[model samples]
Target: MKVLYKKILDLEIWHDYYLGQPNPPKPPPTGYDISDMLALVPTPECLRVLRNLRWLFRPQPRGASIFAHVEQASSGDFATLLPVNRPEQLTFWLIVRDRYFANFTNLPLTTNRHQIYYFSNLSLNQGHALFLTQPLPNYAANSEYHLGQLVHHDGKTLEALLYQASASKNPNANDWDILPNSQYVSELDRLPQQGLSRIYTIPKANPGDIWRLTLVNVHEQETFVLDVTTPITHTPGDAIACSLNFSGQIPGCYKLCLNNIQVDRFVLCDPIASKDAFALVEIVLNQSLVPSAFSLLQPQDGNTLIKPKTYVIRCKNRATRWRYRYEKPHGFSAASLPNFELIDAKTYATKRPLGLRLQPDSLLTDGKDQLLPAPAIALIKPETDTQAHVTTIFSDIHL
Candidate 1:
């Protein structure tokens, strides 16, 4: 049968038979250091139970390890080996780094169901010190336990156990895992706050003109400084109007500022035309800047009338706005309105009639009734004081 022994003081289990023996009759000057041998033995079932209880009470996942298996002794009567001859030590020296456990003066010690045969007094201190042994079990190394079992303990609460485990475990674990909880606690500190600035773009004069410059504040908490490679030239007292055209698309609105001073607000209504959608009513000054050219269509106002019997029809420009217009008069007899020709100043300057037409209606009007005339054609100039006139004549009939 496998025999297990627990320490009477801490209820911690031990695999070494010598740990079960009662304390020697003679007392030593300093407390006994059994942490060294405890390192050789795997965690006792009682110790694992105590660790679980401590974890439950503290509600912390800091110190916890899963046991894969426990080692069992092969020799006869492993617990009768006495206080010194056992293969593993019983006492463990726990070192408290800070005042972590200062409040818990009288800590109740309990272990697994294993029977404890011997124990030493408990001592808590700031520096290195030894505590009494608590023998709980006796197990042979590499006997029944597998190699993957893990054990955990707070460095502050049990520094010696951590060190011993590190030394005994093949290829020691990381220092972080071996250190006490106090050593792992970090100081409460914060990071500095930061601020950012907005981004802006420089305006260009022409639609295709390229401006590679960009203004921004890279620093998280610094003011933005705008420096343009292409210096904007403005008239002595006139403010500059800056607008953005997105790749020949419609223009967008943006605030215009001169030397960090608010001057005027402008918006791009038509990207192709680049007309100012919104501008101050009062024109402070004529910037003398030529606006971009655009194509526009305006409708003519009045109708043209053709005199019956006469092949020629006269028409005039009646529209306030001038635009290119093409007129095609239909519903006419072939004979009444004869085919005519169109002429411009550049083409027929000497001729009395600037425009000609043909294909009048063949249908004749009654002598008493007023008849509709053929279509007249003419080109009118926009914004000009002169009016547009057209003259047409029938080929067969002379007027």
Candidate 2:
């Protein structure tokens, strides 16, 4: 049986992050010491769960982290959060970080489910912290999710954020299964002939326990016999891994399963999406983009795109605002318009998307780390509103 993570306690770890904000230079001390363990245990379930909790770790598809998977849990929020642990669902995660933890003292003595906490220091000059975790399913290790509110911009659509309850399942049996070694399932799914071969690290499940891959779109249809199957390795807790190779013929969404239980959803995106747009946009714009370049399809004046791609609208003369929308990908289902808010923006001397740019005479070098000369920037202003069509190219931005 997989151990589900729950019952966290009040914890404080010095941090340097915050919600919807940038990181502070010097972080403040969290009101706890190094020897504090948030009353946790070391177990197979805890180890896997810990992999999902990213503290002082890179944003997502989290790599090996400082949080050790030893059977014991840290005195902090090192435990990755599981979906079934919702408040009314027998497992709920309650986190009160930074100033909130320090200001509020009327917290429950023992939460019925679990808690992961981080309290801010008594000072305002120190860096605060943000809370993030992984989806307890098979996907890229970089896959991450946050449990807080995100600030947004205007002229975009808005959807009511609601929690739709899934059909109930026994916690002891039906839960998420994380496949550690998977990089991208879409790569294999993109082509019908280009077979996808990859490894999956199953933290639990017998090696012979009837593993199967079912095409989700072809649900209720006949099953294509497995073409190639190989057992790679197995660890304790009945954990095992396998190398699965299949004909890209079944190009669509799919679910890997144990017995009849679903594991995770994987999709094959259009292969053409792999083409680098920054280069194309740079060529079209004539000059090089500063820091980064963004390119996108046309959008309306008031509509907003839910996707993360930014728009560098170079209007005739500081146009007050710009708008964008998402078009359905070439072969995917038609997408409904979603609300978008400005996560970021930049201004530039928008110029004609033609003409060779004058090369720079000098490049700055970072003495310590970077040996490569810094990229030269071009700030040519736009000749007219004609430059509005040249900004925005981001896709496959998952939550």
What would the per-residue lDDT of candidate 1 be over residues 53-123, giving only the tens digit for each residue?
22111111111122211222343212211221111111111222223121111111122221111112211
Candidate 2 minimal-lDDT segment of 10 residues = 277-286
For residue 285, model 2's alpha carbon misses the true position, in angstroms, by 41
Write the residue-wise lDDT of candidate 2 on 1-399 in tens digits: 554433222222221111111123222233313222111122222333334542111111111112212122243222232221211100111222223221111122122221122111110111122211110122222222111101111311111111112312221111121111211111111212112554555666643345554433323332333322334453335656656554443333345554455655443222333111100000011012111222111122322111112111000111111122224322211121121233322211111111111222332222122222211111212112243321221111211
The models' CA-based lDDT, in order, is 0.21, 0.23
Candidate 1 local lDDT, residue 253: 23
- Point out where model 2 deviates above 4 Å: 1-195, 218-236, 269-399
Task: Identify the candidate with maximal lDDT.
Answer: 2
Q: Could you tell me the C-alpha RMSD of candidate 1 in Å? A: 50.5
Worst lDDT 10-window in candidate 1: 278-287
